[model samples]
Target: MEQDLIVVGSGNAALCAAIAASEKGARVLVIEKAPEDMAGGNTKYTAGAMRFAYDGGEDLQDLLLDPKDERLPRTDFGAYTAQKFRDDLLYFNDGRPLSPEQDKLVGRSLETMKWLAGHDVKFEPIYARQSFEKDGRLVFWGGLTLAAEDEGVGLFEAERAALLRAGGRIEYGLAAQSLLVEDGRVRGVTARREDGSTVDLRAQGVILGCGGFESSRELRHDFMGEEWEAARVRGTPHNTGDGLLMALELGAARHGLYSGAHATPMDRHMKEYGNLDIPHGDRKNYRKICYFLGVMVNAEGKRFVDEGKDFRNYTYAQYGKAVLDQPGQFAWQLFDAKTEDLLYAEYRFHDAHYVQADTIEDLCAKLEGVDASAALDTVRAFNAAVDDDTPFDPTIKDGRQARGLTPPRSNWAQRLDTPPFRAYPVTGGITFTYGGLKVDDAGAVLRPDDSPIPGLFACGEIVGGVFFNGYPGGSGLTSGAVFGRQAGYGAAASLSPAT
Candidate 1:
């Protein structure tokens, strides 16, 4: 297959790259490892919220502190926080620093959100602080509503439709095996088809958006260490970080220092039975959120984050240490009668397939099951703190010092001495890796010295320049969209004249 632009993987970044390039009047082609009819990559299974910027109308302009593109509603948190992303990357290179250039990329992302939402990409702009909750004890019902697979997948299909309408080519059910670099430039790619045949694809430029290493156990073990096998893959199995490997071999660098990321049970199960656990017709109000919030524990039967905070931040980087310290790389979510009721209605409890016991003795029958002792102890300690004014200080570690938070988790523990205790057992490490090929604000891949890889562009998880250390809420896909467009537009601009 030959094209002006060849995009690897059908995930958010890959598809968005393809769309951006195609929209810029380039003949683009997107290849996937999955079957033609199957959901090929991770974006299909995402929460789909653009967390970069929100309009919030006229009164919310204060949030737009360091306005970059004038298109996205800028906020102090995003402006300063995103500008300071490089400080988080000290773990890799002490000398390398990212600053103002990143702000440019941030600006582009803001504009991308505005353009996409205006294009009818159904999204909810949320401007809440990021928080964490370990093992999801709070009974979260569904995921943040955004562009569903229908929209995400539809975006890809529409791009293909537009490309074909504009004379572009799309080859699915074919996996990219290697890059054909001649004269230090990406000219084409080697593809492996399902029928076990290899084809050499010629292209003017290539966009690597094949996604992170969620399905690649070898890559997982190499970067994330022990958390690899225990990591529950929330992405489409086809996105095993193949592009990252290809890019690395081609001298590309990684970003987003942390190799791991988050995938909720709601996200994991929904990939297959994922839809079943969501708020359906009659199953909506089976539990309350506060119940799930109260008893959630790490591998050690203790709360690690403020379950009361918004779900986006609470689940990302929080509680990962316990999984790294434990055997199964897993954690548990527990609750009781009244708690379950709160989860049902408030948290929108998904499925009934949880570890349930009518008595404390029965609940501790298994080690992986609910620990009656820990739950009992936690409830007792919390109740004592609440009634006796135990001067409880709520603080959590963010790979940094612990900051004091008012009203420690379970600040009002009412005691769990009653019957009908239940638990939801879920185990999955942070599967999203922030490292990949480095890119500039225009989403163009860069070298170690920060020079753009001419005729080469990248976005999403496949590129690392945007991700500093930890991720801000809505940043992953948001960054992907922002850079994806830039890469597409920027890559197209490189393909000028008689090429």
Candidate 2:
């Protein structure tokens, strides 16, 4: 099929880009392997935090502080990069580019947010006021963390519909197997449809928004190293990086494989928390404290990280355990009646949201196979730390603040002392990947020679440089809107001569 443009993913980024282009009077088509209604990409399962910048938008606090939900703090910066903002601990690679690189990337990030806000996407300013005591264990939480209404899916569908209204077509369950490149320019893409038939899409330009390679174990092993096999797949399950593979086949130069953004997200989410049901996987559940004040321990029941820190920082800390086989592989959140109460009273308003254990022995039985003995011992030690409100004697680097959590006077304060010592298992989920195909500011995929792949473009997760070193809320949608518009409009702009 001949078209003005073709996008190979149905994610928020892809959808946003398609709609942005379609709105501008461009003919576009979106192809996806996932079901039509299923928004299973990173957009489907994200914290959905929309981080507005200091550029010029909302009036918010300079620093993040959540009085009601003290567990997760909100910064005034909203993931903005500034001299006043402290450095992100988890940035392992050269994720944050300076000057020229920063110009294109940060400009794109800010532009994306501006575009989304202009498009009527709600942009809320988190932490516009208030201050609190830094028990030193406070973790940062965004407004976007826990809205599971599938609004993201709705957004994608809305965009897709609008795109179609503006003269675009979306073909779900169609997988692009390869790009048919002629000479140096990308001619088009050959894809597999749902019915096992083949369809060749010929376009004046092609945008690959299919997302990262997180689902492919082989790709993870090849690029991210062997340790990634056990790394949590916390993002959308459908993001298998098919587009990346295709790009490689077309002589796309690879960069930044040695580095990426990894985070340890809580596992057993849908099961343990009773959030959703999965017919394919086993029933897994744990006391859901991922959003609450929590503690993390390893295979030997040792406290690993300051669980209250930024979730991205938590993942970086887990990277330290990479050499330990399951280095960042498994972790557990240890909490009790008091921690649960604080979480509920201020953080989580739901009384029924906590895990209950009447005794240490009972809690042990519940956590039996996972880490019973170690958990029980850790509970006693934790209670001891809480009793005196003193620093834990253990020497965990950068993990002191979490270990220093001594709950301000409560009935259950010293309660490794009683029945039901509760423990909730925490494993990282892959909400997004910090790696992808290299692309220029124009949204064109970069070749081995650092030149644009003609008639080829990328936006969203398909482009790595735009996200900065770490992602802020709304950046994903913002990037797609900003760059998708660029790709679409730019492609449209380029077509004037032909007209």
Candidate 3:
């Protein structure tokens, strides 16, 4: 195919790039490492929640597929201002200043969402997971309230359909091996087909959006640590650093925290690369993120982190690494019957693993790898410290605390004295690597000397430096859209007569 622009990968970022470039009259071709059914990178494995700044309910209502839904009247879609979004990103920056890429992400977030809506992608309130009904009104917390309809799969299908409608073409089962650079400028890529045939695809410009190296055990052991080698992959196994390696081989500068990643508390026995046989919605059941509703203990039967330090969205990404560092790379989350109704649906899934007992003593005894006696003592200490005067409320950070403990619970601290206590085993599941190729504001790959590489653009996980130690929840997809659009525009502009 004689294409004007080549987009590597077929995830949200790649599709957005292809669609945008096609809109600019560029003939775009997207190459995917996975077959068509397993395409869309880590996006298909997600719940499709997207975090962006909006003024209030009105702004959100404008983006919904059905603005006239009856529930919109009673739902409180609180404002998530641009300042709040910047604050959330800075909170996870590990004391570093926000980068230019992050600035673009924040500035362009809402417009990029609107842009997606303009492209026929639909969105709906994330009521099931992010909101709680209080006083006959649904209140959304954590500053994240919207998601693409039907979650990740829906988002992928919608974007893929839009790309096809825009006259963009996708070639499945073709893994890009290296950039086709001629005279120090990228021309296209050399890819290997699934049937072992090699093909040279030439184009005016190339945008690499494949993904990171979270699936590569060797890269994890080398860049992160030996402990990370044992961490289970939460997304596609095909993201084995192919894009990162290809970029580096061409002198692209490396950026971001290679040792850090977006890890989550997953079922201890989840299939190594995640189960593909199950339905898309069922796959998220493997994640156990309700630890905020209870307490987590390492193998030694002791509290390791302040479970209520913040909302799950702010803490869940880094907590998984904490779980990986625990003995046996596992921990158990214990909750009483009090919070049973408040737990996410993932906990109630049929395949969800847990041990339930009528008493704390019995529950501790059932913990597979923990010390029973010490666990009982720990539970008793935690129970004795909780302040019973404050009323429990799940809709907000009510400041109900467990005081005078070694690692005190700062909020939502309820004693596990109720009958039928339950414990769920969990371990760290890596979602994506934090390190990737450094790109400029236009999403053009930059050399170490900070010069843009001609005909080479990048977005998605392949373009890094937007995050450091951790990131706020739902920012990944938004980042991809924002930068992918930028890269597509930049690539198309490069093909102008003046260039």
> Using TM-score as the measure, which candidate wins?
3
> lDDT of candidate 3 vs native?
0.90
State every prediction's TM-score relative to the real structure.
0.73, 0.74, 0.98
For each candidate, what is the lDDT? 0.54, 0.52, 0.90
- Best candidate according to lDDT: 3
When sorted by lDDT, best at the front, the candidate numbers are 3, 1, 2
Q: What TM-score, to 2 decimals, does candidate 3 have?
A: 0.98
Q: How well is each residue in 310-349 modelled by candidate 3, as lDDT tens digits?
A: 8899988898999999999999999999899999888998
For every candidate in turn, the CA RMSD to the true structure comes to: 7.8, 7.2, 1.1
Cα lDDT tens digits for candidate 1, 1-499: 3478888877667766777787778888888777776543655444444444323233223222233534243322223233333333232233555544345555565567555544434442222212122243211111221232233444444434534554555677889999887887888789998999999988888888877776776777787675555555544666577887787777776665545454433211222222223422322122122322345554455555554343324344434433444444545555656554334332333444456688755664443644557755655555344333333222222121112323254343334556787665544434366656777756677777878766667777776645444444445776667777778888888896874
> What would the per-residue lDDT of candidate 2 be over residues 249-361, giving only the tens digit for each residue?
77777754334543434443332121223311111122233332445566666555444344332233243233124334555555655544344221232322234577865
- Give the local distance difference test score of model 1: 0.54
